[model samples]
Structure formats: C-alpha cells, structure tokens
Target: MTTNATPRLAPGPRGTFLLGNLLDLRRDLIGFLRQVSGEYGDIVRFTVAGFTVHLVTHPDHLRHVLQVNSRNYDKQSHEYRPLKLAFGEGLFTSDGDFWKKQRRLMQPAFHRQRILALGEHIVRDVVERVDAWQPYAQRGESLDVAAEMVALSMNVATKSLFSTGLRGDEEVTTIARNLDTVIGYCLYRTMVPFAPPPRVPTRRNREFTAAMTSLDGIIYRIIGERREHGGDTYDLLSMLLEARDEETGEGMPDKQMRDEIATLLLGGYETTSNQLSWAWYELSRNPDVEARLHEELDRVLGDRLPTVADVPRLEYTNRILEETLRLYPVPWLERRAAATDSIGGYHVKAGSLIYISPYLTHRHPDFWAEPERFDPDRFTPERSADRPRFAYFPFGGGPRLCIGNRLAQLEAQLTLATIAQRYRLRLVPDHPVEAKMQVTTSPRYGLRMTLEPRRPAA
Candidate 1:
C-alpha cells in the first residue's frame, strides 16, 4: 500500500539561504521548536548547509522511529557525541551487542520487585534531607528547590548504586561539581556549532579537562576500592561486578564497570531531580491542583510516609508527576541518524538526521488537549486509554526505552508523596520560571521557593 508519490518537503521558516533554521535552533531551542511545530504541521524539515534535519511530532511517527523500525536509527546522533564523551561506552552510550549485554546484566537490578523493595530506603533518604529543610521553613527562608532536589537525588542514586549514601562525601561532591562543568560545556558546544575544540588551551578547555580528570580520579578510586573488597552484594556496583555473559561466562571489564557507573551518575540523578523540581514549580503555580494532591496524600496515607504498596493509591500524585514530565521532559530531544529509511512517506537517505522531542511531542495538539496548560487529570486512565502508546513516553519506548524508568517512577512518586505529606512549597513572588535546556531541562534561574509545613490529616 505504499505510494510512490514523493513526499512534500516539510514546511519551516525561511532563514538565511545557507543557514536555514540553524540560527533559530541555536538561539532558543525550546522556543524555536515550538514555533516550527506550531506552524509547520507534524513534520518539520530545516536545512543547515545542505543537511536536512527532520523533527517528527506525531505519535505514530515517533513510534515508527523509536520502536517499529528502530534498527534503522542508531545512537550515532550528533546529540549523543557530548554524552558519549562524558559517559564513554556505558549502557546509555553504547549500541548493538555491547548495549544489549550491559542492559541484560543490569536488568535484574531494576526489576519491579527490586525497585519496590528499595522504596523504604528512598523515603529514608528523603526524610533525612527534608528534616534539615525544616529549619529554613521555620525561618521563612527562600531555598533553591531545584538545587535541593539535585542534592537529594544524588544521595538517593548513589545509595541505590553503591549501598552507600553521598551525604558528607567530599570526593563525590567534587565529582558532582566537575560533572556540572562538563555537562554545561558540552551543551554550549552542541548548540553553538562554531565552538572551539576541548583540546584548545582556552580557560574553558582547561576547566573542562580538569573537571574530567577529577571525575575520572574519583570514579577509578571507587572502582579500585570495590575491587579490593570483593564479595556478592545487592547494590548495582556488586551486581555489575559479579554478572557474567551467559555464553562466555565473562564479567564486565573494569573500564566498562566505570562507564556504567558513570552512566548511572549522569543519567540517574539529573533527570529525576529536574523532574521533581518542575513538579514542585507546577504545584506552586496551581493551588487547586496542589490542594487536590494534598487531599489524595491525606486520604491515602493519613500522615504515614508513602510506601511502594501505596503508590498505586496515590493516583493524583502520579498524575502531577506525569503532567510535569509532559511539559518538561528531562532529555527534551532525541536525535538519530537515519540509516536508509522513510518517515511519513518522506525518503530518509543515509546520513539524514531525525529529531524527536518528548517536550514537543507531549504538547502536540493532535494528541493533547489544551497542550500548554497544566492538567494532571489528562493522565487519568479513562482519558489516557485512547491515546497512542508513544504519546506519553517520558521514559521513551522500545528496546532503548530507559532501563531505569521503573526505578525513577518509584523514586519520584515516593519522594513527591512523602514531601507532599508534610510540606507545601510556594514560589517567591514574581520569580520568573524559565527552562535552561541542556542534556536535561532545568530551571534557568533555580526555582526559589519557601516551604510551609502542612497540617497532619485529621
């Protein structure tokens, strides 16, 4: 049934003859994308120096690219290069056989049961951290909620990975600081095409190199220490160390172990933290939704900290998180280099690039009602049942769907529910909310908010 009609060129804004939409894309990626999709229908083609970039907005089209014919789209996208430099050949960066092997070895750690079992530990970390925030609440202090979540998520992720929390760990602190430097540097280069190489002896290059060296030193130290204390343990570190290929009975090499752990550090905490930050921002902006969330938490737990068993009952809380992700997905854009394919009847020759944004696709008018508004009920089972499977993929889809998705959900839900049980966050008056797009979507100016202790459910 395939038609031989040549697909019409995707509509987009006219830019300088040679640059096409490159300037718009680099200047304001989020706003530029919204403009393109808003005006140009579902598929947008923007040519940059003779290179055609396709941004697919429809759910069915996304599924085709991410799930159905995913084999034709490898992880050789331009966006992945910076991440590959940061993470090396880890599960998040590798492809084909290597990715498959790493994914298999790590799958058991993130099993539903295991993720559920870790709920108590996650709450304990949240409780410990939030307890300290109480003093600021009492003093009416405005705190950077985004930074707070980053710190909290780092502790949770590290604890989950190593069975040792990062609180009071100077080495981890230094490593995290350097990771920030590297991520910011990489993001800038990705957007600004003419940026100099990292090898140049500029101040920025030196900083990036120093950060990478510091990160490497800390990671290698941890790996060496783990090797010295070898024994079977339930943490991800031990699991990775002990796992062997079923056929060859070979374990992951030390370098791979480091890569996977680094992958955990980069991907694990960053997205969940950003998601929670945006969730709080949305909650603060919508009092009615916040009230409903509180009511749900009150009815579900009645002052008890949320457990994995209670997550299903905290339906509204989950909805808020879902809605937040819809508005601001962590990894906003997914890029792939097409390997001889066609999308929406358009011939996608080899070397062509495809861009899919959960941030944009989740807000596509065809799939979402009032796409710009914050509406948690949009995620209610009845409402969501009719939507295409790819319409709401915060964790992505298909073989490359994020392996840590279940764990992230459990972590976010538990953390949000636990905090909602005890505190309500309010944004500082006139504080502007803006997204700073990088590998993850973060608040441009950190979300500044004051905490108010909520009354216990009667």
Candidate 2:
C-alpha cells in the first residue's frame, strides 16, 4: 500500500471541492507555482480530482525525475493519448519504438552542418522582417512584438523545416492563422489530461481540425509534387522521406509522415518564438544588457548577417537566449510516469506521475543568486561551467531531449544576432507584459515596444 512505505514527498492542500487549483493556473500560472515552491520545499505535492501531482523544484531532484530516473518513466498516456488524436504517433507525444524510431530518423537532419546549411534562409527572413519595421522605427511608432516574434520564428521554421517562405498570399496567411488557433486550443486542453476527445462542433476543436485539414492538404500536395518533379532537396520532410534506420533501414509510412509534419507544426516554432519574444522583453527592460548585446553584435557581426560560423563568436547573443530560457522555458513543466517500483531512501510507485518544474528550479535560491533578475552573466562560460549539469536545462535533458534542439538554437542565435544588428527595440512606456498559460508560456497582453534602426557600423 502507498500508505505503508510512505514516500518522503506528500500531497499538500489543493482547493475546495468545486474549483481546485484551477484558479491559480488560470490567474497566473508561473506566479502561483513560484508561490507554492517558495512556501513548500523542493518537492511540493498537490491534489486535484483525486489525483496527486508532485512538482519537483530542486535541480538535483529535477534531473532525478527527468534524466536519471528517465527510464522509470514514459511520456504517460495522460499527456500522450489525446495528442495522438491529432499528432498521431509524432515525437512530441510518443513513446517506446515509435519515439525511438522517429528520433533516430530525424536526428541526422538537425546535425550542426545540415542545420548550418539553413542559415541563409535564417538571415534573409530576419533581415526582411526586421527591416520591414523600418517605417515604424523611423516614425517612432511602437510595435507589439508578441505577434511579430511569432511571425519571425514562423518564417525561420517555415524556411528550415518546410523549405518554403510565408508570402502574404491569401491561402498561406489564412491557413497559418487557422493552424495556430487549432494547435493552441488542443495543446492547452491537454492540461486536464483525461478529457474526452474534442468534437468537430467545439469552436476551438473545429478550427484546429480545420487548420490541420487545410495545412495537411497543402503539405501532401507539396510532397506529391516533389515526388513527381523529383528534385533533390534537404529540408526536414525530405530527410524524413529518405531517412532509413541505421540498423534496420526501414522508413516511416505515409500516415507517419503526416504525424512527423504535425510534430514540427505543433512543437517547433512556438517555443523559440516565445523565447525570442521574452528575450526581446528582457533586453528592453535591461538597457545595460541590451547595450552589451548591441556591442557584441556590432563587434562580431556588424551589419552583415551572421553565418552559422559566427555563432560561437556571438557569445552574448547565446547567453541572452540562455537567460531567457532560464526565466521562461517553453515547457514550464515536464512529466513522467514511473515504469517500475523503485526504492532508494524513497520509493517511486510504478504508476505515479512525476512533475519537474524548470521554472522553479532555475529560480530556486539554493542555486541561483538574485534568481529573479535578468542577468545573462549567470550563464557565462565560467559561471555556467561551475554549475551542475542539469541545473540549466532549458531543453529537456537525456536522449529524449528535443530533437529540434540544434535547429532551434541555430535559429535563435542567428535571428537575434541578425535583428539586433539592425535595430534597437525600446519597451513602450506602460506596456504591460503579463503571462498567459497557453500551449507554451506566452504573453497574453502582447509585448509592446518602439523600434529604431541601429546606425550603420563603420
């Protein structure tokens, strides 16, 4: 019995019979979690609907749940099953051989060299979009970077993964807007973890399904055309189509193809875009940091777009993104279900779920000094080297680490270096930056700012 060998962590109070901690999640997700972690110690527990979820705060415990004891866990059907209804067996919600197979198939495509080949597209998009803001910059007009950040990142992912650009064409624009809505709705509802499948008539459900339909139609058409036309290309779709398991040499089926594309659709752009949006917000508030970023960009990149080779040289840009991920990791929480009964000083029940909150670990006082401040130096080469391996995991750790990790990093560093080389963004006065618990941690109020083109480098 669970009561007999009581685990060190125990469930604390949640809420009344009617509401649950739903109010905390609704009003301010990150703030509420921070309050709970500060009040409770490293391993905090709570109950909702007769279920217990443990929120692990300490970095060591985080790795214990996410990395060390990773094998003891699966993605769990609660998180995996509903997503399967839409994404099917894609990497984001898959386990066992399906995830293993997909990870192997797609890993080669994101190799540093292969991803570096996508750099030109990264520069062109960052330049065009950031340059398009010139008029606003010239007129001293403010911009809400929330949507702009999405547009910027969508362009990067669209270019790298889709191997196409987003023109202002009616159909492409419509499908993108619709697709974003549907994906957001489905992902957010997965929080409940046990709801019945959303039906066609539910407004959000309809949009998600409709958007998937429209987009899938387009992608399938493209694949068909590519097959017929038969040109050599290096995009992710092409890689997936051609990749063979190193040992078995088998490829994914057509149905799996849709899932793979849907995986990138749901998992790719939002995380990096939100990260950049937050970086923009953080940089604007901390002028000294922004100045240091500008100095690094000017000294390293000047006005020319940074190539992938310039990535390591643009150290500050990398650190800014690092700091951003620390504060607003796209995945605020990651969960795992125990696959085996295990004992140490503690026992992990086979069926129990473990929740690891990076949001809390990154801010915990035991590890980080002045944990709330926006300090890129926290991730400096020397400082970060001294920290524990799992202390700063913006990307989830272990083999199941994000497949798109390199591609995302390549995009963020190049795009930030590219754009920051071109303009200085000033947070507009009194523009409220509030958090929203969306598919990712997002800005509901929109991050508004004024943009001014940087003077040309001598």
Candidate 3:
C-alpha cells in the first residue's frame, strides 16, 4: 500500500524527560514491549535518547521487513553491537558478501542430512545424561533442571563440534565457562547502553577480557590440535577445516573458523538448552500435555529410545517443543534499521531501528487466542493452518533465519522424547520460575525439579 499524504507518527508511550524510553527498556524490556504492543498498535513508534524506534507486531510488516525487502534492513544496527563484540563478524554478526560466503562454507555442515546424522550422537548424549539422573531420582534430590539442560546441551554441542564428549575435559569445560562469562557480560553491556567501554579497566571489563583470553586460548589450542591430527573427522570443526570457497578454492582462516565455531557453540547450546529447560517447566505444570506426550512416546517407541527415524512419528512431542518455542524463544527480540522505506503508513526514515520481537508477536492477541495458555495443540497442522507464517517465527524468518534451526528442532525433539521415555521431571513445589533475559532468555532462578523414573508401559 502507498501513502498519498505525509505519514502520521506511530503511537507509543511517552518516556521520561531526557532518557526517553531507555529506562523502561532497560528495566523490564519484555514486559515493556508487551505493554507497548498492546497499548499502541502493531507498529508502535518510540524514542530512545532521541532516536526513533518502531516495534512491528503485524505479520505483513514483519514479512516485508524480514523477507521481501530484507536488503534494506541490515544486521549492523546498534542492537547487535554487543553480539558483534562477543562473536566478531561470524555468521551471527556478519552481513553482505562476508555473511554469504561464511554461510555457504557452513551450509553443508548443517544440511538436513548432516543434521539428521547428528541425531544418534544427540540421543547418545541425552541417554548418558539421563542414565546419571537415576541417582538423583533415587536420593530424592532436587535437580536444577535448567542447569541439567545446559550440561546436556553443552555435551551435545561439544560432541557435534569436536566429535568427542567433554564430560571430564577441563580444558573444554573452561572454554564453555568462559563463553558463558562472555555471554553474561554481553548481556550486561547490551542492557546498559551507557555502561563503560570494554577497554576500560573496570572489574567487569577485566573479567570479560580474562574470559575472552581463556576462550581464545582453548579454541586456538583445539584448532592447532585438529590440524596436527587432520586425517578426516566428521565433527563441524573438521567440516570448517575442509570447507573451501568456491571461487578461491581456499579454506577458511583460523580466525574465521574460530569465530564460526564460537558462534555455533553459543547458538547451538544456549538456545536449545534454554528451550528444553522451559519445556520441562511447562510440561511439569501441564499434566494433560505431559500425558499426551508420554502416550505418543509409549506408542511410538515402546521401551526403546527415540532416534532420528522416530522424529516424524513423535508429532505431539514436536508440537510441545513448538509451543514452548512460541512462549519462550531464546532470541526473544530482533532489531534492524531501515536503509530506506515506508511500512504500514509510517515513514521509516533511514537508520531508524525496528524491533521485531517474536516473543511479543507469538503472543499477539490478534494472532493467538488465549495467548497466555500453554497448549501444544496450537501447533497441530489443522490449528496452525490459518496463521501467518511470520506470526510464529521462533527461529526467525527469511535468509538470516537461524542456520541451525533443523538441528535445534531435531536435537530438542530427540532429547525430549528420550528423557520422557525414561523419567519425568517435575518442578519443586513453590519454586519460583521467572524468565531471565540474558543474550538468550532462560529461567531466572533456574528450574528446580525432582526427577522420577517412569514405570514401564504394560
């Protein structure tokens, strides 16, 4: 649609005298975004320290911004500056030819067939972790489900990236811890816009630098070791090691490979782990849904574990994961700036930031009925047929959509099915579960739950 006249200003809540909406955004971003989406219309325009910001909730607008005219909206927006700090110009941060080249090199590693092949590894990781959970179950010990999922996903990530388990590998564990430290620091930096620069010798900065140093040391050590022992390895590192640019017929540089691997570890592990943790939280609260999930698992696998082949038949399990993603997507908010254009009758000037929050859109009242309810059936084919594709973009949409989407889904589905087959994770009574918005959204207090071995199906 074209605007014949000057476009009206998009409506939004007024902010404080000088800071604009900066404080509100920093305080409770998710809650503030929700209020703004409900109070203002689909395209809410707000200001942050005099810069215009637009929050887009409608699907058509999302499609237009993300897919149809994506080139105009680049990833170099200020919102991604923190991530760029942590990951450099890896696939998660790069744009243009650089991004395309990296994507091409990394594409083969995350192909559907390749992702499917990794399922056995994923299941093995899940089974090993679950087998150990029996001791906690027997002792009536309360396990932090969120931490458990983190460990599980971390194992799966290391195995996927290095083709080896990291259970007792302190060097790799140090790398993982350092990555978490960096992620935490990045989250802090992203939230507090006025925070001191990293180069400053502040306590946080020093810790962040130390973490980066440790992380770099581990990643470089692994790269050097892989080069020394390089015959053929099926891990993603090996794939990157061997990947060649079509034009130059040259392999990626060590720096580039390190960035990609670091990006994959952060993306692959944190998002999947958070989602799986949230899934357990939801399942514990919703017994009916859990019952249906169990019924599907019982009917499909009997006493055996879930494999890649069982992914399709575990329809309800997949729906449960889909619903969990709808509620608690790890990357809850995304930002892009208009290179140039108009959207939904609003004149989006060049360099204005547009906020595309799947968290808000997924729970949009207009799109989803009873938006707060946790019902996995919302993802059933019949129910899902009527919604716009952009209305539920958990992995996002368009070309920059998450490269590991299929792998994440496969891993979560397999992990969920495998665990549900053997044990039930129930939340501890009166335990508070709050959403913590780090670089990825996760449980605030961590999900405290007790595990019980499920009786065999008769």
Ten contiguous residues with the weakest lDDT in model 2: 340-349
Q: Estimate, for each residue in 265-304, the C-alpha lDDT of model 1 and write its tens digit.
A: 8878889999999999999989999999988988989876
Each prediction's RMSD to truth: 2.4, 3.0, 2.2
- What C-alpha lDDT values do all the predictions have? 0.82, 0.74, 0.85
Q: Which parts of model 1 have CA positions greater than 4 angstroms off?
A: 1-8, 165-167, 192-197, 456-458
For candidate 2, the C-alpha RMSD (Å) to the true structure equals 3.0
Q: Which candidate should be chosen as best, given lDDT against the real structure?
A: 3
Kindly list the per-residue Cα lDDT of model 3 for residues 233-302, writing each as its tens digit. Answer: 5678888888899999999888888888889988888899999999999999999999999999999999
Estimate the overall C-alpha local distance difference test score of candidate 1. Answer: 0.82
Judged by TM-score relative to the true structure, which candidate is superior, 2 or 3? 3
Best-matching candidate per TM-score: 3
Error of 1 at 169 (Å): 3.4
Residue 406, candidate 2: Cα error in Å is 1.3
Query: Between candidates 1 and 3, which one is better according to lDDT?
Result: 3
| CA shift of 61, model 2, Å | 1.9
TM-score of 2: 0.91
**Model 3 segments more than 4 A misplaced:** 1-5, 165-167, 456-458
Q: Which of the two candidates, 1 or 3, achieves a greater TM-score against the reference?
A: 3
